[model samples]
Target: MPSLTLEQANQIIAGALARSKASGFKPMGVAVLDDAGHLKAFAREDGASMFRFEVAQGKAWGAVGMGASSRALMQRAKDNPNFFVSLAATSGGRFLPQTGAVLIKDAAGQVLGAVGASGGTGDEDEAICIAGVESAGLSAG
Candidate 1:
């Protein structure tokens, strides 16, 4: 029953931003959410769009809610667009089935939270999330 700490959340964001910068990706926004789908931390780099945090949070929120990676949800949504649309409505527009977020898991495979990013391509965004999770000494799902 491990939970994400504020320090870990901040580390995740810092790692994500660092990765984005090292890769020469555009300015990025990152969000972290605990297992209960509550926002734990967030960051938007200078020059990033105002909407980045919302997009990143939406992606992570959906991951924490569904207990899966945003990439996985994106694939599922492709098979059932109607169902996903309904899900979005039920989440009050917070659920976003996109490829920019991943579940954060402990060594025992317990879900601790999720990390998500915006301002890059889907692959780029997902990569940064993974990097952040690993940097925090957690696994990414």
Candidate 2:
């Protein structure tokens, strides 16, 4: 199975931050995790809050652990609130079923990992993650 390289993770972070800056969103925190849901790289913009990192990582971790985009998880939560809420405790609070994250896939549709962002609306954060994945020559889902 193909794995995500540190260089690629850095590229994704840079791309996400650039897009966020271009769009005039608030300072952001971006996190990239490996297929195993391990932190690969992270960045918090100058003005972002310290808590942004945890929020960003939680969203990405949720995506990687569940094998789906955080947006999908968000919808699932809407359908099964109790189970989804329980999942947060199950993950020890590292999972966030929100719209600010996306799974990263390779050309073969293999899960490479996930990217997530915080410090903006859910839609804005998700947009940056998608842009980052695309800019890094990966697919976002």
- The estimated TM-scores of all candidates read 0.98, 0.98
Worst 10 residues of 1 by lDDT: 1-10
lDDT for 92 (candidate 1): 93
**Residues 1-141, model 2: lDDT tens digits:** 699999999999999999999999999999999999999999999989778999999999999999999999999999899998899998899989989999999888999999999999999999999999999999998
TM-score of 2: 0.98
TM-score, predicted candidate 1 vs. hidden true structure: 0.98
Kindly list the per-residue Cα lDDT of model 1 for residues 1-141, writing each as its tens digit: 578999999999988889999999999999999999899999999999888988999999999999999999999999999999999999899999999999999999999999989999989999999999999999999
- Pairs in clash, predicted candidate 1: none
How many clashes show up in model 1?
Answer: 0
Name the runs in model 2 displaced over 4 angstroms: none
Assess each prediction's global lDDT (C-alpha) against the native.
0.95, 0.95
Clashing residue pairs, backbone N/CA/C < 3 A, model 2: none
Write down the lDDT that model 2 would get.
0.95
Cα-based RMSD of the predictions, in order? Answer: 0.6, 0.7
